[model samples]
Target chain A: MNSITTPSYAVHFNQIAYTELNKHLSQSKYSKIFILVDENTHNYCLPTFLAQINEDYDFEIIEIEEGEVNKNIHTCTQVWEVLSELDADRKSAMINLGGGVVTDLGGFVASCFKRGIDFINVPTTLLSMVDASVGGKTGVDLGPLKNQIGVINQPQMVLIVPEFLKTLNERQLQSGFAEMLKHGLIRDAAYWESLKAVLDFENIADFIYTSVTIKNEVVLQDPTEQNLRKILNYGHTLGHAIESYFLESPKHDLLLHGEAISIGMILEGYLSFKLTGLPESELNDIKASFLARYKKTTFTKTDIDTILTLLKFDKKNSHGNVNFVLLKNIGECAIDIKVPEDLLKEAFEFYAE
Target chain B: MNSITTPSYAVHFNQIAYTELNKHLSQSKYSKIFILVDENTHNYCLPTFLAQINEDYDFEIIEIEEGEVNKNIHTCTQVWEVLSELDADRKSAMINLGGGVVTDLGGFVASCFKRGIDFINVPTTLLSMVDASVGGKTGVDLGPLKNQIGVINQPQMVLIVPEFLKTLNERQLQSGFAEMLKHGLIRDAAYWESLKAVLDFENIADFIYTSVTIKNEVVLQDPTEQNLRKILNYGHTLGHAIESYFLESPKHDLLLHGEAISIGMILEGYLSFKLTGLPESELNDIKASFLARYKKTTFTKTDIDTILTLLKFDKKNSHGNVNFVLLKNIGECAIDIKVPEDLLKEAFEFYAE
Candidate 1:
């Protein structure tokens, strides 16, 4: 594919990404380069990424422990202190070479270190490539809440090398596939229909490219999430709460982000049928498509109640009201739709069915 | 005298500030209004500020401890939690009603909360009114390093009510005055001469206005502190190191920001005379002026050595070189000037004189 242009930066793919990154590095006189990574990326992805650098440059690998649990302010504090200890000055550049947790936290670290510094995002996960690659939303989870403490800071460039997808487990691939499915659901019916079939892991690059293009177009219009950008949070309203609930609960098996959100899309699809005139047939299609791949987990009444309460803390909430983005149709989304609690319970029941 | 318009927001003065604030409050449909204060502002300033709120609105008072000690990410976390607990959504507006500590930290909190939110700076301290009001440099110090973590986020407006000056003690007032003096030294020599006379606290409002104007003009050109803005740090390089050293050292008496920077101006002035064509006569004049107001603190050889080491950590530093903004003349400034360690030692000796 070709390079994707954002409002401020570019998203380069495969060989082009390496070329652009090298060109950029040569032109910008960074005093030093700090590559942020997680333990997983350090072992699996870092060697390949480091090999792509064409020049003999000063590089520091600052690795954090992997996973969503590590993505918090404490981690940020440690990284910042490390940067300071390592003499990472204002002129130094940082390259975030991991998944969403690494990119988001690393971008925030770079943006905030000495007011702001230049950083590049080398997303190593399918999830990060499809979702985090386009948006300037860089932040860390606040306690159990997801992405609560963060800022909208764009990277200098984003490099999406699809070969890294091979590093991800089947669960991780499926998790990323959720966001790609979200792109189709929110804006492209034809794409949504195409995604209903089995995800072709062999041809994943094309899917990643399309997903990024969809996200890029939306964010380019509303980078700040003022209005149009809220559409991107289609399933995220309930999805995040579900993710947070499962993340916090010791009893439940950790659901991959995609698995939880897959359930969110089904519940939200049901809400759309009742509230926004989404056809019952389309909603069923949405449910069947996700259910075919993701295992259906039973939510106890307490779980349902807790998740509903958690909705109030959603970043999308305003005026003490939990807002949802429901599909008017598969290709179209209606933002800021205040879904009633009783109807939400009904949507959950629909998910169970 | 008149509203100083920034690139994005306006700085409303005294009575006009209240009017603009009230007008703004009435116009924007904020979910809630959060007033961030410290213990001092809560006791001294909030009563008067609350009275100015002509209309009854949902208000939450989020107080952090007063002083620079409390300005850190830990305090930010507390405030962020409180904002979340208080349901401070994206539509909610925050009014930062304290000194530089409150305004800088609160602006950072409001900006990073839920990505970003609208905030107003109600600068109660002269330091905040003149320096923190216009720059859009919102941050908290990391360990002893000042402003190590933050972003350049502008407020919706800045309200400078000089009456708030009455709430500050002599030390607080003096601390703010140092920054005002900085404005004159960096940009307006005549203003510097005028400020050398004993500060008439009754007429302090005029000084604040002029200082803000000088700062506003500079920030309007380069809000990001890329190049020209470094001149604002004319005295801050050594000043910050001196402040940090005192702040962290248990043996030393706590120096007000102004007191430390006052010394910094004298030392840097000597360096300027030696390295940047600043007249020795003017350098002596700068030292004499500060000595007349501020008591000379003894910095032992160890203290001097530690402060010099801290210079490497300054935000202005890039490419492993500690950069300084020196005075070319009384009103003129030179940026990115490199000073050697031997000359720096000599400059400290000049201060001892």
Candidate 2:
């Protein structure tokens, strides 16, 4: 498959393409290489990574504790201290060798270290391969607010090798699938319908690649989220709020990003039907398809009110108004749509139905 | 004077220019405004700033504890939390209202806030107005390391109002003067000679403005420090090491940035004479002028060894080689020159003499 390009970087998708990574490394001639990983990937993925790279390169491994909770400045400080202690310099290149938490934190760390060093994302999870790959958005969550602190900086390259997906649990796989579904719902109705047929994990690389291309095309036209790129946030605004809400409430289980976003897409589908005239039948189809895959998540009345309040804190919002990305039709979206409170309530009711 | 433009953002220099700031505030139409300050600026600069603005603005003040030691991830978290709690949105503009520490941390915070928001710098110190005004460098020190964690991000505008300098102590004024002297040595010989004639604070705005222009021109040519931009680091290489050294060592008082760099320029001048064949007379002249202004700093043999070791940690370095930017002569310098250990020792001896 051909490589996808963002304004500042490229995304290369190959199945087990260690040679491609090696070739790029030789050409760049980095002073040293450092791989950032979480405990899980360090244990499961490092052996394969070491075996595949057929070059004598000076490299070291920096590991952080696993999971999204560890994705904060505390971990960043630890990693930075390690890099300093190990004497990493401006010419050093960091290979982010894990899932979204690893890549996101590593990308941010590298971008700020010496005003940025070269970083290549070797995404180990499906969510990162498609979602995090194209968007040059690198950041960490602040106090349960997802991605509140970060910079829009592109990595040197993104190397996607599908074999790493073999280790992901079922929940992780499904979480990644939600983003692929988002790509389809926002840009390609045909892609969305085809994705509905995907029940198993067999032959998912092509789908992931397609989702990345869709996102890349959108980002190329609007890198700064001024207009077209906002379409990519169709499910994200509400989804992110819901994700944060659950993460903060001890009573609720933490919603994997994809799971919360799955709910968000359904609610926004209903909003699209009411506000943007997205066909009612298509809205039902969208909800039904998502509900079929992601187990239904129930939000209490108070939870609904809290989520609504959280919407004001959404980065997309301005002047205390929540601006949403709503679909005009499947595969077509509108940016900066102001949904009324009654309509938002109705949309949630529709999701419950 | 007219605004100076870099590839990204503008620097506006005016004396008590509330009208210009009001005009910019109205034109920007930010959802709200927030001013970031330290205790000193809040006490001294804020009232003057409030009295000057002609237009009404819906703004609030957020104050952090003063000093370079406070520039850390902890402060960033606090500010981010405050911004979140206060409901500062993506469209809100942040005014960094103080010296280098405030501008540096505020710039980084704003840049990372929601992937970035617009920020305007109101530099209250001479060090910031001339030096920090141009370069998009924003960061805080990591564990006594200067600017160890930061991103190269420009503010929406840099508003340089010279009246703020009135409140600065003599030491603060001298510290800032060191950078101005550097501006002359690295690029403009005539400017250097003109600055030497300056013994009073009256009519220093032109000198500050000239230094800003020289730095801006260099930055416009090379924002990434790929080659030409490294010229700006002429004194910064050894200077940073020395700054970090004193900041960490219990035996020595902390050296202000400009004081450390003053020493660095003399040492590098001596190295230039040895390695780059800079004229002996010119080197002596450089040393004499710096010594006349900055109090002499003495380093023991152990201090020299430690500073040399710290050089490897300099962000400008690559592959364990300490690259020095040496002067070919006044107003001219060379980048990436590797000085041998013996010469580095000799340069220190020359400084000690």
Candidate 3:
């Protein structure tokens, strides 16, 4: 049983699992409850969620198509209209019960519905539980761009349940592991070492808890992303560009956010070795760990050029400069480091290897 | 030269005028500049604005179609794509240079672009200068619903130039006057009487300044609209429903926001007289002032039923209750006041007179 509070909201672990959720709901006395889920979560997670909560409060289930492509303004409009049609008032609470797609879109829809409404995240995927659901960054993509339209609005609460992770496939689980690895790389060496030592799902709950705590701590310190919060975006700059690139390319398979970021970490690690003087041994360790888990992705000369161009659109960029967060050491990262084009090409070469 | 700062941003009247805007722009040193204008403003107001700002900065003009219909997600997508195609970075600054449609959509686009960016509102309409530009509420309409999907993010600055009002037609001018009169009715009896006494466009600048000040004061007190801010929505609850109803109905002409709210104020005045014991004479005075300026609108029995049904969708509602902000007196309002259906019908009858 553990609880952590950010400036805007709170995250509760096993202590306030199901019974606590019912109690919180009863005490809050919301007018009605609406649960937002994509097809996958509606099929897999909703039944388990229903079984846990004993309260007979009035609630409705809203299902959207699952996947990254569905995370757009059209979907948002549909959800908003549905909420309005259902007569969801300001006092009504929404529970987002799915992965990143559901939580991100639902959080945004809730935030803008009638200016805003109370929403809680009950993440049903490893990727979302460890990463997306913890932070207040909720939004959908604009065209092929990633999170181009959104606001930094926190949810009322985030409930993390490990039982929901039973539904994730191996790739989905690995996708989430990338962020956990990121938490260790950016802040804690021992945590990184511990995560690397155990790649199995035996203590997945412990891993999620630690990841959540690390992300929550960083976000709490810098909710507005003035300085410290940018550190949380260590792999995100290049990672996001790559994610958007592949998501838009008709020929390439869509890369899960974590998968793209994993490649970004490897490329950034190489850049770190070249520019930031990160030890070659640590860089090798990083490369080996990522390559072993994530399938190697190849980019052509044209693809590289496109990715470079896309980097300018990264929200982190200011004054058209593509800033990178490179690892100074395995556990320490430096921000706003500008890397040379030649070194970026070499980093891509290293990732391809 | 008067400047008032809200918790979110600042409103500069005459002091931080065009010259100050030029200096502010130079000091900020943004990556790029963009001006969002509707066709009307582009044709009429852009020349005046360009002439005042002597400094030449790298800027582009992005124009959308004029009127309320264009304030939708599709328009937002087009503007976002244009910004993307033009490579507008996080440091880019957007100047919303039109009436409420341009400012509302542009503010929302800028807020969500790259998570958020710096934007300044240069309101070109009386309604916008006094009301829309002051509050941080920015969004496009969802279907016939007004401001259904939006956020409460303020601009970096609001620059109000009354010179833009010279281009407005009499109906448009009167539309804005409705809100000014509302400012007086809800908060300042003296202000209300002053507005009633002078219905002509002469001394319109003083009226605009006073209305902006009053609205800013109320918004500053409650940015989140939890308590004090709800008072500002006094006429909006029913007014919004009526506006949305007419906008959707093929039989009726689109009512200007101020026009719809004027009728709402009269209806609410009747409710206030019945439920809150607002003086019969004051209610009569309120009705007379509104009818003198705005042409009386007639609502059939079906229209009233439809408008009443639409009340449930008002953003102000909670727990299915059509909560309203009713006038307790000419100078004060009580929020979250629920009026019975019978009383609502009577209020409509009072408006018909």
Candidate 4:
């Protein structure tokens, strides 16, 4: 409640995680409260969340239909119209209890409502709790593009209760794990080795903490993603294009955030091997590990070609060059590495192995 | 062309007026450039704007269709799509050139694109150059309602070239003049009277400086509009509802911003007489003078009833209470004055004179 306490938000994570809903929420300083749940969260997560929170305080429920496709300006307007209808005033606070789709878009909706209102994030999916919830970057994505439009606004607090991750499917977990792996690879060799053993969800708490810690520390310094933070985007360059490309095809399964990112890491890793002197055998070791864990989704040469086209248009590509975050060995990354067009196909081929 | 050393931007009557714009903008030092313009501005204002700028910089022009009806999340999406297409990067700067509609919506789009690229605002319309442009408030209006979604982001610099006023019709100029009057009523007394004679389109440099001076001082003290600065909403409390109601009707031409505020001033002035014992003669004089300059649009009892009903849903009003900004005196205003529904009706009747 004391927002000025300078985001000692870490101290409250456990309190947020384990405390009985009634004991803490009844004492919450918010005058009026609401929960923002996307369609998926409304169906899958809100019922449980509703059960836990005490009914002592006045509360409202706002639900938006879920999915990455809905993360557009039109959806944001619908959410705003609902907020306006509900008489959401400055004193009102929203608890966004959903995945990255809801958390990111809902945070942006709340941020723009009357020049902003305080909101708390309870990221439901592993993708959101560990990744999207930490950075305070919130907005719906532009059409077919990932995070094309948004604002940077930190929430009052992010309530990370991993109990919600139990609802995430196996594909979702694998997808989320990719970013956890990415966080470690970009900055911490020791953290990477420790996480390399996190094969199942049983030991997720440690992985989440480490991943969020890496993200939080980077955000604390750069906040704006000017220099050091760009390293956090290690695998997302081609990963996003691949994700968007797949989303366009009706036959393709919806890839979770981590799944797309996992492929991104492997592709970027291959580029790293070719451009930087990352040993070919070590690259194989990295590819084998992900390939063994994630069932390979074969992309036709044409699918990859479409993705490559999008990569050229990526926001990361400064000055019209396809800039990449390439790995130096396994633990390091160098920003702004330009990779040629044909080599992209070679990297994907290398990643397939 | 040194931006920082650009000569003072102000309207001088018998006083000096100054505000810093380049000071904050120079810190950004962008690489590429972008300008957002509405259809009206693309034709009327952009030529003059391009002429004034340094010819060396390459720029991209993004134009949106005009009208308050297009101001929404959809419009923002189109603008984002354009920015993304142009390969706008972190170093890209956007110039929002047009009216309140353009400044507010353009500012929001720039703030969200790539999680906020730096943007400067060049307000061509009077309402924006003085009111919407200065507050760092940016977002689109919702449907027939007023500003329903928005963010607070100061532009790198707000370029106020009164030359754009030449393109404004009398109705548009009257719309913008309301804020100038509100600025005077809330902050300075002598400046308000001088404006009755000094409002010459030919000699507007001094007037622009005067308006910007009061706004800049208030914004400098409270960049976020937390306290004393809100007094600038004196007439706007009911004026906006009146404006929204009229805008939704077929008779929008009859009711402009200054005209609506003139009515709001009369009604609130009557409320002020009841609430703060403001001399009745001063209230009469105020109403007469504003009416002398601003042609009045007659609202039937039913129209007043509809506006009052709409007022119940205003973002500024809470708990089903109308929060009227009442004048304590000629140059003083107070916020959060809860008036009885009956007294509000009575206040309207008092203005029937």
Two-way lDDT contest, 3 vs 4, winner: 3
TM-score of each: 0.99, 0.97, 0.97, 0.92
Residue-level lDDT tens digits of model 4 in B1-353: 11211122322111110123333334555656888898889999888766645334667999988877778777887888888877887678888888877888888888888778877777887788677656677887776567777888867666666778899987788777777877777777787777766555566656666677777777777766677677777877788789888878885554666678778888888898898777888788778878777776667888889998778666666555677778877777777788888888887887775
Quote the lDDT for B229 in model 3. 84
Worst 10 residues of 2 chain B by lDDT: B12-21
Cα lDDT tens digits for candidate 2, A47-119: 8888888788998999999888888888998989999888899999999999999999999999999778899
Positional deviation of residue B295's Cα in model 1 after best superposition, in angstroms: 0.3
Model 1: per-residue Cα lDDT over B66-116, one tens digit each: 889989999999999999888888899999999889999999998889889
Q: What TM-score does candidate 2 get on C-alpha atoms?
A: 0.97
Q: Clashes in model 3: which pairs?
A: none
Q: Model 3, residue B268: what's the lDDT?
A: 92
> Which tens-of-lDDT digit does each residue in A199-303 have in candidate 4?
689658757876777788887888777777788888899888988888777878887667888888888888898897777876776787777777787888888
Which model scores highest in TM-score? 1
Candidate 3 per-residue C-alpha lDDT over B291-310 given as tens digits, one digit per residue, 9 for 90 to 100 = 99999998999999999988
Candidate 1 ranges beyond 4 A from true positions:
none
Of the candidates numbered 1 and 2, which has the greater TM-score value? 1
Worst 10 residues of 1 chain A by lDDT: A195-204
Best by lDDT: 1
Top of the candidates by DockQ: 1
- The digit string of per-residue lDDT tens for model 3 on A164-205 reads 878888888999899999999999999999999876775688
Residue pairs clashing, model 4? A39-A66, A175-A258, A175-A259, B10-B209, B11-B206, B11-B209, B11-B210, B12-B206
Given candidate 4, what's the lDDT at residue A18? 31
Ranking by DockQ: 1, 2, 3, 4
Predicted model 2 interface RMSD: 0.9
